[model samples]
Every structure is written in C-alpha cells, then in structure tokens.
Target: MKTFVKIMLAATIVLVAGLWFSNSFKALNNQADALEQPTEVIEQPIIEKTKIEPVKKTPFSETIVVETAIKFEAPLYWAVNDYGLIDGYSSTEELIEKYYLEFTEEQLARLFTEDFFYNEADGVHVTASASPNLIQTDRDFTITELNENQYQVSQVLYTLDDGETAYIFVDYIYDEVNNNWNIAMINYQY
Candidate 1:
C-alpha cells in the first residue's frame, strides 16, 4: 500500500509540470510575435476624373406693351418720315441736335449712314410730323435679339382715322466704347 501511494504522488507532480511548461512556451511565442516589426502598407490617393462643360448662350425674344396713346410711337414715326422726305434738317448734326432728347448722337449717325446723305444745300424746312390720330395698343412691339450684341425692335401701330395698320422695324447695335445701344437700321411701312 505504501509503495502504491508514493507512485500515485509522483505521477500527479509530473502531469502538473508538463501543463505549466506548455503554457509558458505559448506565452513566450506570443510576446516574440508582438515585438517583431510590422509590414509596411503604402496607400495611394484616389483621384476622380470629372468632365467639364462649356457655358451655352441663349437668344432672347420678348413681346412688350407700351401703355400710351401715341407718345412712344411719335418719335420713331417722325424720324422715319423725315428721313424718307429729306426735308427735316440740313445735315446729320442738325437732325441729331434737334432730336437729342429722344436719341443720342451715335444713334442718329448710325440711323443716317454716310451713304444715305450727300453735301446738298442747307434747308430749314420741317416736313414730317406725327399724325394726331395714330394709336398704339398693348403688345404692339416685339424685341428680338438677332445676335449677342444686335437686336431688332418691331412696332405695329393703328390709325384712328381709317383703322390702318402700320409697321416699323428698327435694328440696334451695342456700342462697347459708348456703353449704349445705337440705331443700326430702320424700315417702316404705313
């Protein structure tokens, strides 16, 4: 019985020592792995390519209404008639001065181009005048942009005496130096 007891004690001590040594070996391996240098991982920046679009220009067109009897229509009618009759004033300068309140010098010059007038005798005759019976109603004018710097204003008028329709087309060009719009052309039919 005594020899049996001593043999059992020796077996238990060996089992415990074996388990302790195994656990110590695992801990040492984990510490070594933690102390080692880590692998380098370089990250590249992400670049996204986007498409750029150009700005598009849009043309302008609109209908306008001048709410008055004939005040707005008188100046244009008088100018066109005087231009056709060639009896308003002597020269372009005189015409521009006379209508300076209505139009600018640059505008008058463009309306009466150099080819339209000749060096003739100076006359002091006023031959063209606006009729008292002419009337302008709502939506009587349409303004359209021909290009980036050019525009056309078309007007329609009616005669109270005979109920006749009249048409007027005026072209305007933007002058960058003068910072204003000048009359490029005028055409009318009564």
Candidate 2:
C-alpha cells in the first residue's frame, strides 16, 4: 500500500508539468502563425500630377560700388595768442595749457614724422600747420595713392576772416616699424 501511494504522487506531479508545457507550446505556435500571416493592404486614392514649366535664364551682371572717407585724426593747426601771433612753447604740455588744445602730446606726435617738432633760434615750431576753421564747406577730398604705403590727400580750404581759398595737400606715409601711417609732409597752394 505504501509503494502504491508514492507512485501515485509522482504521477500527479508529472501530469501537471506536462499540461503546463503543452499550454505554453500551443501559445508560442499561435504567435508564430500570426507573424507568418500577410498584412492587409488598403487602397489609396490617386490624384493627377501638374506639369511644371522650365524657367527662362537671363544674363546677370553684378555691379559693386565702394565709398570710403578719409579722416584726419589730429588737429593740424598752430597755436596762436590773443594778439594774433604764433605762440611757441617749451614743451607740448605748455602749448596745450596755453592754447587749451584738445590733443595730448602722444596724439600730436603721432600726426607727424619723428622729427616734426624741433627747437629753433626763437622757439619750438611744427613742420606742418593748418586751421580746422579754415576747412571749406564742400570738404571734398581727392585721394591719390603715391605708392604701396604712401597716399596724398588734397582738399580745398577757405579762410573766413581773410576770405582766402587755398588748396591743401597732406601726404601720409606708412611707418613699417610702428605699423601705422604718419603725416610725412603738408603743402598748401593758393
């Protein structure tokens, strides 16, 4: 009786495992069959295509215009006293203080060559001189390229007090060592 009971218990466990495996296998087979089946194709409505015309090609010409204005960075004038005399000072600081000029010594120095200012028998004087108030109303500038590093700018100036018209030419030369352009010379013609 004991042997028979043990055999029955083993058989019941085997039967339950077999049923579980059979159900799992059947579910996997059903999924594979569904994947192998072809998908449904829905019909789409067709519309007529419109014809596109070819664009006509035209000859194109590109024109470029460039305008540049040259500016004088420093004042090109000599300091004068109340008595209408060219005032000479011992140093730039003294000249600025006496004339109430806006330029610093360094800025004034940059406007000319290294030896622009020198002491004479009477007093210190500059090589180039012009008054800003004398510049004409038109202020038209004619720029000429002298060389690769030199440029000459010519303009007409008018004096209000004397009613004088003069043509002023300023030459600028590029300083290679300093990598800047400095006023090399200035000339005037009536």
Q: Give the residue spans of candidate 1 off by over 4 A.
A: 1-92, 97-125, 128-139, 159-165
Clashes (backbone N, CA, C under 3 Å), per candidate, total 0, 0
How well is each residue in 41-111 modelled by candidate 2, as lDDT tens digits? 89897977988865443211111000111123222335353322335566544544443222122344344
lDDT of 1 by residue, 30-140 (tens): 888877959587998988888886444323334222322233334344433443434576665665566432333355443443434343465333333433322234455
- Quantify all predictions' global Cα lDDT against the true fold: 0.54, 0.51
- Taking all chains together, the TM-score of candidate 1 against the true structure is 0.34
Question: Residue 44 error for model 2, in Å?
Answer: 76
Residue 189, model 2: lDDT of 85
Q: TM-scores for all candidates? A: 0.34, 0.32
Among the numbered candidates, top TM-score falls to: 1
Candidate 2, run of 10 with poorest lDDT? 59-68
- How many clashes in candidate 2? 0
